[model samples]
Target: MPELTTRIGDLTMRSPVMLASGTVGYGPEYEGVIDFGATGAIVTKTITVEPREGNAPPRLVETPGGLLNAIGLENVGLERFLAEKLPEAAPLPVPIVASVAGTGAGQFAQLAAAVGERDEVAAIELNISCPNVERPRNPVWSDPVAVGEIVSAAREATGKTLSLKLSPNTSDILSVAEAAERAGADALTVANTLPGMRIDIERRRPALGNVTGGLSGRALMPVNLALVWKVAEHVSIPVIGSGGIGDTGDALEFLAAGAVAVQVGTALFATPEAPSEIADGLRNYMEENGFASIDELVGMAREERRTCAETA
Candidate 1:
């Protein structure tokens, strides 16, 4: 059997299929519905320093190929997460990756430190660039300087593995990835949801409460794969490909493009069992292909391109 286990920084994941933040609702929501053992890790919803009620109603709308959500990082505050949610998540079989977002670098540092203090958390994923909020704050990942500062602060606050989630809305993703790398990020979640919106013609208003929201689903697979390929070429740290992974094939595309792991997000809304099914499919595909480990598949596409170029 192929070795499905992989490492991101110091944390070892049994599989490379993680449930993306905000999709799984703190790891325990799908307990009996899905097998937790099959997933690499469960990243909790992005938590904030204070409880946010999130935006007004109509926060989500279904689009042609994806979902547009403006949830606004609504979650139980840090205190509630630590006191209530963490305990519930601690008993799960897979590792817990706490996802956090904050208004500023200082708040981000505080959130990271608080989450890191928990023995159950295996890693921290920094949500530095959510696009659905109504606030006028600048995204930390959009500027290399801000990326470095925020990542540095979080790095200092957490001893656990740190994974920085970058925004697709940024002009130069490579520069932001490099900034995160230089600031001591252990891993990079190549890209987040793209900014998008829809209007209700009948109501004469925006489809989402926040007016615009982040888009995620099948449409983002190619975009996310390109990002993974590009970031993998420049950064030495592991890259966790995210955005639109929906099945084994989608996940394999990311692996072939050079992501060490992949996160399944929008798919879970439709099929709760998607993650485990993809993991099983991966194992079967690896064995059938005579690959002894998942690592062999990582960056295979890049190698093929290099070989073709050399021949030419």
Candidate 2:
């Protein structure tokens, strides 16, 4: 069998397919619905310093090919997560990557230190790109300097492997990615959901209560794939691609494009077992194609492109 093990810094994942944050609701929600051992990791919902009520009703609106969500980072506070949520997730077979978002560098550092200390948490993902909340300061992922500051602060606070979840909303994602790499991020989760909205024509109001929400699903795959490719080309750290991935083919595309791993989010809403199924498919594909490991498949598309350009 082809080796499915994937490593991001010091952390190792059994498979390249992981459950994206906010989709699986920690690790216990899908106990019977999906196989936890099949996936590489589980990124829990974005936790804040305090518990959030989240946006008002109508938090989700289905578009033609994607889901627009304004969940507003609703999650249990750090204390509860450590005491309750983390303990509940203890039985999960894979590593637990705690996702966190905060208002500033200090807050991010605080959250990172708090969660990074827990034995249940294997890694820390700094969610600096959540679109639902309104903040007085600019979004951290948009500015390279801010990205450096936030990532650096979190980096200092955590001994655990740190992955920075970036945003696609910015103009120059490569610069931001490079900044994160320089700031000591172990890995980068390329490109979060795109900002979008829909209108309820009858009511003449926005479909989502938050007016604007992040767009995610099949529609986001191509866009994020390009970002992953570009960012991977520009950075040395591993990149974990996330956006729209429903099956093995989608996962393969991201891996070939230069991602070490792929995260499945919106697809879980429709197929809870997608990560496991995709992992199996990946193994089957590698075996049939004679690929030795996931590393051999990673960045194949980029290599092909480089070869073509050289020949041309």
Candidate number with greatest TM-score: 2
For 1-312, candidate 1 gives per-residue lDDT tens digits of 789999999889899999899888887888898788899998899999999898887989999889999998889999999999999999999999999998778998999999999998899999987887754555666789988988999989988899999887877899999999999999999788999999999999999888998999998778878888889999999999998899999999999999999999899988988998999999999999887887888887897655864586
Model 2 score (lDDT): 0.92
Q: Score each candidate by Cα lDDT.
A: 0.90, 0.92
Q: After TM-score superposition, what is the CA distance of residue 295 in candidate 2 from its true location, in Å?
A: 0.3
Q: Estimate each model's TM-score.
A: 0.96, 0.96
Give the runs in model 2 whose Cα sits over 4 Å from its true position.
Answer: 304-312
For lDDT, the strongest prediction is 2
Residue 285 of model 1 has an lDDT of: 96
- For model 1 the TM-score comes to 0.96
Candidate 1 wrong stretches, greater than 4 Å: 135-138, 304-312
